[model samples]
Target: MSRSLRRGALAATAIVFSIAALSACGAGNDAQTLGVRPDNAAVSVDDVKIQNAVVITQPTPGVKGPAVVSATVFNNGRQAQTLDAITLPGTSATVKLKPAEGTGPITVPAGGSVVIGGEGNATAVIENGTEAAKNGDAQKVVFKLSRTGDVALEAFVVRGSGYYKGFGPSEVPAPPSATPTASATPGGEHGAEHGGESSPSGEASHASGH
Candidate 1:
């Protein structure tokens, strides 16, 4: 084989290898982008993992409303862990936890998980002080655990609609009913009677003058 032909063959092999390398890199990038992250927030503290942490609020425009915390608490330890309370930063809102059974702290069993704000599950409500967070906003939520301590993360705020229709706080105060205004004419019958009496009085006065 000629030296020039040998050099050309080596160049062709190098091009093929370069193309293979690029293809591998592209596949790696595609694999990395395969899965979508959860829309809600999540945090792991030691053996405790808080997944799908979200705040569902019933807020109106410019008015704060009641809210609830929804998440799944997973305990990977050997013993059960209790969720004490959840708190919001920079707000006076108080978080009240309602266990699934009895009036006790929410407990996640060992090597198991507890769902919050789910059907027939534990509930964490933000009572009294309303949540001012609007839909699609991120609010900082601090989860207090028995052993893991406090794990704070910015959870996404969603409205109590669609997928979260029944996830709102149990005790959302109803808006004040508008007081009915006193009608200018109290009753049609009363106004008619007054008109009739006034007309008769005017007619009698005119007859007397005549």
Candidate 2:
């Protein structure tokens, strides 16, 4: 090769090596150097089971009253669900859906869900039932709809009964059967008597030990 051409090639090779070394060093020093993009990060909402939805209060739009609702979200999947945000469901000048505090991007653990209550404290709002009634015993809560997989899609909210109540609001406590209780005997006593063995406490004894 010509003298000038060889010198140019050598200089280019040195520049490439220096760039590679800088890249490696920077990557090792900080996580930002890993070339991660927040916009491309995976976020999903799945296994969304609505539990105990209720309307605690109503909203006030100008002279019109407000429509408030509440419900619990159950996560029945193995992965965590991050609720990005919620938008009002229907178009009613008099109606509005309110977003609760810390409503955006909530993390629900696997095999678990979060309970959303208080009509006035909803993450988003939607129109339910007829406009004349101006009351949503139940409305469609469409999720922002994103998943760990590529592309953020749309998700629909299923309709179910027993999710709404009147102005009176009460927490839906767990079922009584879920509570733990002590074992009992058939005779209403503490222990069971089988084959004259009496209780395990050895309270009753036979004369011959038989």
Candidate 3:
């Protein structure tokens, strides 16, 4: 065999080995399993990943309100898992979670994911934040997983207005306006009776005067 041929063959073999190694290491693998967060705002641990975790602010400071946390939890493990709670470190905000019906914690199906902060299902509610979490700020929080350990990451603070309209702490939503109902006149039947009785009295007075 020629030296050039041997060198070529060696190069080919090295390339093959490198490809195999990357495959074993899961090149371009799913974010959940690899614990490789997609965005800088994302974090994962033990196949349980939370992406885009954020706190929706109450817009104005000194209002003293709770901010809501929104994130998409992905469980890449073979078994199902639950999210027990999430805590914001170094902040006055308390965590309030609305668990899935019949499940105490947020449940993630095997190989499936669940998205929080939407209008539908229960989500993490950050209660009693005085002035810590402000608009355009970032807060670090730790997620307590049922199977996996704590996964901590920074969550951005967004004002719940304009693009983030309609998101805030749970409040007594303003009651819908009552639609105008078709009914009688402004004074009802009493005014009509009064007008009729007044007309007769006026006629009697006119006759008495005549």
Candidate 4:
């Protein structure tokens, strides 16, 4: 090789070695590294691909409470579609496409994704969840449509810690039940349960009046 070319090659080798050393020093030093993306699971049926799917709630979204699920539903097809209803057959919670305002299904723009149940914006809402609604379980959910057929997906149950903890089952007070307690016998009885007839001194007033 030429003199200048040989020097250029040696400099490039040193730079490559330095870059490798930096990478080795910074192993697993990201801001946050999770074992697996539990919330980033995806399921595809037909041309529809649902990504980052997770049902976020406390433990259970109590009766009339909220069972929120978030996901990015992508329409790989050429046309637009509307998500009519979402149902959790494994749970009692009914799905709503519009949580803020009670309404019908949400529309998915053509070749795009619709984000449901994000932070502060709860799009698909499930009401009236039961004890069976727990965390770390795969819930069998169905997404209904107007024209297209229903699509079933396994949505994971993500437990709440900070912001989404309110959806857990409420600690409602149980109804009061009667319980027996110790009490003295009726009719002015003393500490003793059974006492002899009243003494003459204890029963006097009428004779004195006569």
Best by TM-score: 1
Candidate 2: worst 10 consecutive residues by lDDT?
201-210
Question: What is the per-residue lDDT of model 1 for residues 1-210, given as tens digits with 9 covering 90 to 100?
Answer: 999999999999999999999999987776235321256677888998887778877633233455778887888999998988889887787888888778988888999888787556788777743544557778899989898899899988876655565555544433344222233358867766554432211000000000
- Local distance difference test, each candidate: 0.68, 0.37, 0.62, 0.53
Candidate 3 worst ten-residue window by lDDT: 201-210
Structural similarity to truth (TM-score) of each candidate:
0.62, 0.33, 0.59, 0.57
Error of 1 at 59 (Å): 7.1
* Clash totals, every prediction: 0, 15, 0, 0
Write down the worst ten-residue block by lDDT for model 1: 201-210
User: How many angstroms is residue 135 displaced in model 3 relative to the true structure, after the best TM-score fit?
Assistant: 1.5
Tell how far residue 10 is off in model 1, in angstroms: 32
- State the displacement of the C-alpha of residue 131, model 3, in Å, after optimal TM-score superposition: 3.4
Tens digit per residue, CA lDDT, model 4, 162-189? 4334322223211133122214455554
Pick out the ten consecutive residues of candidate 4 with the lowest summed lDDT.
Answer: 201-210
Best by lDDT: 1
For model 2, residues 19-126, the per-residue Cα lDDT tens digits are 999988887765334322222112234455543333333222112223323344556677776655444355331323233444345554577655443333333233
